[model samples]
Target: MTITIDGLSIKKKEDFYANIKTELNVPEYFGNNLDALYDILTEHPDRLQIKFLHYDRMCAQLGVPFCQKLLKVLQDADILTIINQH
Candidate 1:
């Protein structure tokens, strides 16, 4: 299934992870951090198609460093993450 993240609603790093965790149905044991995110994305059994809607807002809200980290994790993970600028 394709999971869409509404970037405009994410105001902080916490929100970013929380949104992902909720939408992706991430496990309770999940660490809710970038490292954990990377691990989960790489290890999860399901093939996830992640779509980031209004991605520019996310970058603006979370800042470039956080955005870079998130994107890097997604890029390196063995899953496809699409940035939907619209």
Candidate 2:
């Protein structure tokens, strides 16, 4: 089953993005495979720390490894995560 970052069905994604954007000082991008995209978020130490804190504090967040897991299962993964999203 493919999942989307927005598909998490939380109170609101705007809240999540707000925190991540504030924490990293960068705008967060939304995509179907949020798990895979996590790497881009955590590639840097400062960014990773910010993201981890956001996960523990504001919401139960997932990281990049899970994204890789999902990426493997997806056939249209590129379209859903990379091309179609941007």
Candidate that scores best on TM-score: 1
TM-score of 1: 0.89
- TM per candidate: 0.89, 0.31
RMSD to the hidden true structure, all candidates: 1.2, 12.4
The local distance difference test score of model 1 is 0.85
Model 2: clashing residue pairs? 35-67, 36-67
Per-residue accuracy of model 1 over 1-86 as CA lDDT, tens digit each: 78898888989888988888888778988896889999888787688888999999989998999888887888888668888897
lDDT per residue, candidate 2, 1-86, as tens digits?
12223324323445545543544455345443445335444453331211122222223344445434544533232333332221
The local distance difference test score of model 2 is 0.37
- Looking at model 2, residue 83 earns an lDDT score of 20
> How close to the true structure is residue 80 of candidate 1, measured as C-alpha lDDT?
83
Clashes of each: 0, 2
